[model samples]
Target: MSTTTLLRSRPSRPLKGGGVSRTSPLKPRRSRLLTGMMLLYLVYTLVPLLWLLLSATKTQDDLLSSPGLWFGKTFALFSNIQDTLTYDDGIFLRWLGNTLLYVVVGAGGATLLATAAGYGLAKYKFAGRRAVFAVLLGAVAVPGTALAVPTFLMFSNLGLTNTVWAIIIPSLVSPFGLYLMWVYASDAIPHDLLEAARIDGAGEIRIFFTVALRLLVPGVVTVLLFAVVATWNNYFLPLIMLSKPNLYPLTVGLTQWSNQATGVGARPIYNLVITGSLLTIVPLVIAFLFLQRFWQSGLSAGSVKQ
Candidate 1:
């Protein structure tokens, strides 16, 4: 064919909406708006934390004189920590230990019980399952504070008041955790997988341990972290249960120290309070950072089939 004929025979490309073929640059207004919203939220969440961090590094005088979100004239973070640890015959260290103990036992046990119960409720079909779930859902709606007075009275009658058990025992029943695990397990652990494991001669317990447990890691971590935080920050329960300062967790202990500021003998250690608050949150931040990858993996596990 001739070159002119061949050129004429080629079809012309259609224009989008029969308009100009010129490409428009991608509009970034939505992206910018989303970024702005994220930044606003970050600032809202971080401002208080920043204030705490900065205040921890200042002496009482400096804290009063200095700007709220900037460094003070003198950096006294190490000294503040030392003073916090050494204050009142080193009671802060004891409080720290007690807090750790409560978190380990209470949160760990809560996680285990929640995981088992949730998995059972999701996978098993037994008598009173719906009733149990209904009661659990109702329990979840009940604020813990509402139960504190009754719990105190009951524990007092049982001669368990002013003991570690008062704190640990109550924390072990996490209705929210149970509910979370139930929802997560229902989606994460496929029915077919469970059937396959059973076909291969696996017992229910063994299948749960080896198969469901692996898949439920993210939800488990979430519940465990929440339980840990709740137990760590628990004040009312420990305060109402235990009369002794020796048994106080960090939350109660810190508050006690803060109250000394206005007590008749008024020994204001605001620096230590601020410093201790900063230190208290550090472990939680570390836990999140460490478990973040696993948590992310667990959340996304069943999104795509293998």
Candidate 2:
């Protein structure tokens, strides 16, 4: 036998315990504890939504009498929806319109502003950039509720209170969205690509619209969804700012309906309120489902290094 053939045929040494242990590739190991916890969490999250769905189908009397997680004898979902829409001269529809306005203008505008500002901050080298970032971080740390009183006072003085501007204006400033976009833009858009675009004689605005915006689809969708949810669910700002029911968003209007059930006059529109709440969430659910792919991509943006 040749020395080379002897070397090649040498036996491998065994690991500790006299053999190497290997897991089956097809059957990955999983922790039962973690699986149990996740199952519990799924139940926790889904139970309330189930209850809401079941409760919405009941009449006022049935709603009061029925088990929260089960359907009542009478399925009055359509009836409740009709009542919710038509009650008080279809004020619910007005509130729905107001919410759409706020979401379209306020959320849409916020996403635009945040994307521009964040992209600028990430790409441009300017004086006080660090200071601006510091301020943004501070703003994100400060909860909106903390600023509500001051915002109300400011809007009151400007005669903007009780107007759509009160809600729309404040909803436009999303510090978290700005921060998210800044981080996303920094990683998602290559600096070299922008330079190449500039070299190609494209103006900054044109570059942003053509190059940056396309690359930022995921981030933009994420920020837009966040802004929509925030503005749609905004309760305190609208509650404090607007006195007129006409200007009320779904959040405030639904709350007002809920409150009406408890006051001395006590108009128990529980069925309408429940159905309205269900209707209110449907759009958000659809938006999330539709944009889910982009949103997931956006969230996973910075997880891996290029």
Candidate 3:
């Protein structure tokens, strides 16, 4: 046989130990372990939510009488929702509206500021950049709750207490969100793109709004969601800052309702509290679900290089 024919007849073999094998014995084990861990996490996360779901369907007596995780004899979800909305002259609805307002202004502002600041920090060679980052890192390490008292005092001195500004101002500054945007912008946005935009006679502001902002959408949405959740769930700051029930966010307002279940002249409206809590989470859940696609797309896009 010719040498060429002989070589051709020989089966092609992969280079020794160089390429990844299609089937590895360890892979199945790793996959199973990962799947098990994920399932465990899902169960852990869902259990409380499940309990909340079931508990919301029950009346106060049924909630006390029934098994904690199971449904009651009668489902009163709609009735409970009605009571929750109408209670105290629809103050719960007002709290919900106030929470939305805070989220819109505070979280929206935070996202805008964080995105601009992060993009600038990533793209620009500014003076005091290192010091700014150093302060930001330090601030990130500090617990927000620890600063609540001091912030309340400062706001009080400024005569901003009992006003929406007290909550909105504090919520606007998100060190972590800024850091996230910085990292995402550094990776997601190409410097060449910015230069190209400039070459086209675009101003810095124009480049940001037109070019960089489009790429930063995913990160911006992520930061916005975080800010929304933070502002929406903010309890301590509002508790300290606002003296009037009219100014309370849902978190504080709901807690006030829950507290009514205890002490003298207690309302015993535990059902309403549970239902309100359930209602309070719906908008956040919807926001997450709606924005999930953008978040995932942004993350995936950021992971790839130009």
Candidate 4:
């Protein structure tokens, strides 16, 4: 511990022929900067989410006047939840159920369809394949909102207006999902494996379902997550397609409550709307957390393979 002993213990010479090493000094500063930026980013993204959560626990007056993060003295978290659930003959529950139905059916169907289509595109070299892929690429860039009116008109002509199919049909055709699957399938699955399977007498369909399917679980999870969230949060399409309150998704139902809050005669449903919004996000949060491992592996696989 003495000064002379400490001096003797130090490096005998520079790592590279008397050239001073810059690694230590640069690493700490770079680490500090990265940590600080990450902390800032977390606060930036989470502050609004936290504010929404706190706002939900308070009454309407408390929401407007109280400090954003602090809870009001009277904890009405339960009361607000009750109001959210009970409002308008428990229509919120109906909307929640409808939202789940849409997400499960639409996203499930889309994921299945997209996976099959993408696998084929990536594995096979058929005529017009390039053109088909090009069309999907163009569709990926097209904003889905742009198709709402056209979709509405088409569904209306077929007597599908005000029905769930109007929303479900649109949700099925996710160009981005197909693109993701194409990229993932091409990169992750080996052509040699398919040839081996063929030599073993496995049919194309059987080979895909058995051999490639397990390998593609990560990509499937990614597709399911996006498809589910997109369908769950779809508001504009449903707004134009379905007019029935019973068919409304959570997003539409929340908007209706928000509108009611603005009305002069009705007691402001701001508290209920905020509370509903908070509850609405719970399913998505739970799903993402549950699938975190899958998504992490999928992304890492993409990076490592590249």
Question: What would the TM-scores of all predictions be?
Answer: 0.86, 0.87, 0.87, 0.87
> Model 2 — which ten-residue stretch has the worst lDDT?
7-16
For residue 123, what is the lDDT in candidate 4?
96
Model 4 Cα lDDT, one tens digit per residue, 1-306 = 344333333324223423444555522225787898999999999999999988888988788778889997667899999988998999999999999999989999999999999899999999999999788778877877787788788889999999889888888877889989999999989999999999999999999999988889989999999998899889998999989999999999899878875657766788898899999999899998888666766766666553
TM-score of 3: 0.87
Q: Write the per-residue lDDT of candidate 2 for residues 1-306, one digit (tens) a residue.
A: 344333333323212332334453333467799999999999999999999999989998888787888989999999888999999999999999999999999999999999999999999999999999888777778877998999899999999999999999988988888988998899989999999999999999999999999988878999999999998898899999999999999999998999998969888788888899999999999988878755665565555444
Tens digits of lDDT, candidate 3, 1-306: 344333333324213354545465422225687898999999999999999999999999899899999999899999999999999999999999999999999999999999999999999998999999999888888988899999888889999999999989988998889989999999988889999999999999999999999889989998998899899989889999998999999999988888988899987789998999999999899999888766665656565553
> Tens digits of per-residue lDDT for model 1 on 1-306?
344333333324222343443354432224687898999999999999999988999999998899999999999999999999998899989999999999999999999999999999999999999999888878878888999999999999999998999999998989889988998888888899999999999999999999999988888998888898888888899999999999999999989889989958999889999998888889978987877655555555444333
Q: lDDT of each prediction vs. the true structure?
A: 0.87, 0.87, 0.88, 0.86
Residue 27 of model 4: what lDDT? 26
Report the error of model 4 at residue 20, Å: 16
Clashing pairs in 1: none
User: Candidate 1, which ten residues in sequence have the lowest lDDT sum?
Assistant: 6-15
Error of 3 at 213 (Å): 0.6
